[model samples]
Target: MNQANFDEARKAEANYHNELYSDHEILEPGTWMSKPVPIVMELLERILQHKDHVTVLDLGCGAGRNTIPLAVRLKGTNSRVVGIDLLEEAIEKLRENSNKYDVADVIEARKGDAEQVDILEDAYDYIAACGCLEHVSSEEAFIKVLERMKMGTRLGGIHCITMNTDIQEVERETGRALETLIELNLPTEKAFSILEEVYDGWNVLDRKTTLLSIDEEKYEKPSQFRCQSITFAVQKI
Candidate 1:
């Protein structure tokens, strides 16, 4: 999509969230996970090691699930954490939560897109992007964002990312007539193929396949739901 289209969609998303706050519980990150807290905490602890005076950035930091917690952890230290997302409401809610949860000063929330974020190169020690890549218009744009993140990080900086993977088995088992839905909305094995080919030098810390399931009610309709999961960390060269 063009910059104008990207920006307009982002603003609309922000407006939607701003007008609807309490109802924000419809769906969320890690909704598919049996134990999301532990998963997120594990990743945070691993990324925010004992580095003094480090800066961390969260791309697509929707509603501060990871942002607020990371800020709390980094508080009382020289470390700073910033969370950026396309939704104004997400950013606003994140800011309120930061204050309510007592990390407002440490965590700065902003409305931003990964493709257009402006930051100094090699300024951050750790960058995190959970459940975001698949939503981009294309894999090429996704990698471009990754490349920007890479440039925004210091040498040896860590990048934590989670993506939707191919889910043929789930589609078969669930009998979801969503193969086309999955293809159009979520990343596939081909997406990873592109990532592997493009970012050959990055280390793969952890890789896993997860089904996009929440509770016992597996979705089978033509919906906006993405249908797979993958998480891994890479160190910037």
Candidate 2:
């Protein structure tokens, strides 16, 4: 698909999220996960060990799940995080939570597509785009966003990305598989193939590909689908 098509897909996804949040207050939130992913926090800790100041970008930062705690951890280090989400309510809720944690000064929130948001060259010190990439409707759009993120990171900068490589969706009532949105039907091998090219010069610190699932019923769906999640924490060369 072309850029225009990709833009339309993003708009549609944004509309979906807006509708999801329409029933409640921006700050009316529940836990998306039990806690911050330990590995992600560990990596951030290690990255901050040698830096006096850092700039972090948290893409698809839903409800400050990871953003708030990271800001608290990086407090007094002159570090700041800018969270970008397609849902305005998500960003607003993130901002509200940041204030509650007294990290409002360190966490800034923006409403926009993470892939389309502009950043200065070599700007971010660390980036996280967990549970986000599958939303990109086409391969071309995904590659463009990945390239942009790579270019925006400083040399030696680290990125933590998690993507659902291939997810077969089923109807709410029927277990039969249905087509996913646009070109998100990417298989596991294909997703890795793209990554092989995307991180050519970068060093992979940690990598894993597996089913993205939890035992919590709250996080379960009514449909029968298999989600292959790919995670990578890499440093720019």
Candidate 3:
């Protein structure tokens, strides 16, 4: 994908999210909105069940689909979540909803590009990158982001990264778009191998890939749309 394609895809994503944000359907299921992936919610519930006063970083946290519930879960506790997204509107909406849900104190909304893998400050108890990794520019960027994530996590910190392979995208084969969405097209097999190698010495909590059904009303290709999502829930060793 050229710069135009990348920009257009990003614009589409932002517009889609903005639409859902306007409709209050970004967090719901079986609606004309983007539903939170099951694995994401599952891991979050587990995280909450495991810790109370934890610090979290939510990457690609568009409009607080994941951040809101997390903040609500951590409200009144010493826990905190720093939510980041590329779209300023999404972050703004996140801020609004955080207050609406009375979790403004717990959620810190900011705008940042996930592909940059920017770690602001402090070691996080948990880091979540749902629907974020494939947006990276290249395999090298992927490795870099994961390495930074590992380095930024506490010794026992957990990370939940959920993303689609290139198969899920029409423009890029491997979803490693550097400069543009067409910068690289990595194979799924090799991608997994790299991940395995990268985590060779770390504790692997959970890693899997599956094709999940999409809501037709919300997805353009619902008839044949399936999210070939890869999920990694790991702990820093």
TM-score comparison, 1 vs 2, better candidate: 2
lDDT, candidate 3, 1-237, per-residue tens: 567776666665666667767767455664423455565567666666767788889888888777887787778988889998888888888998888789998998989876674684447988898877766666788888888877778767778887766443322333332232323344556667777777677777788887754332223432222455677777777
Which residue ranges in model 3 land beyond 4 Å of their true spot?
A: 31-52, 120-122, 166-186, 215-224
How many residue pairs clash in all the candidates, one count each? 1, 0, 3
lDDT, each prediction: 0.65, 0.75, 0.70
As a whole number from 0 to 100, the lDDT of residue 28 in candidate 1 is: 54
What would the TM-score be for candidate 1 when compared with the true structure? 0.75
List the candidates ranked by lDDT, beginning with the highest: 2, 3, 1
Estimate, for each residue in 111-138, the C-alpha lDDT of model 1 and write its tens digit.
8867778967988888888866655666
Better of 1 and 3 by TM-score: 3
Give the Cα error of residue 123 in candidate 1, in Å.
1.5
Worst 10-residue lDDT window, candidate 2: 213-222
Most accurate candidate by lDDT:
2
- Model 2: residues with Cα > 4 Å off, grouped in runs: 1-31, 171-174, 213-221
Candidate 2 vs. true structure, TM-score: 0.83
* Winner on lDDT (2 vs 3): 2
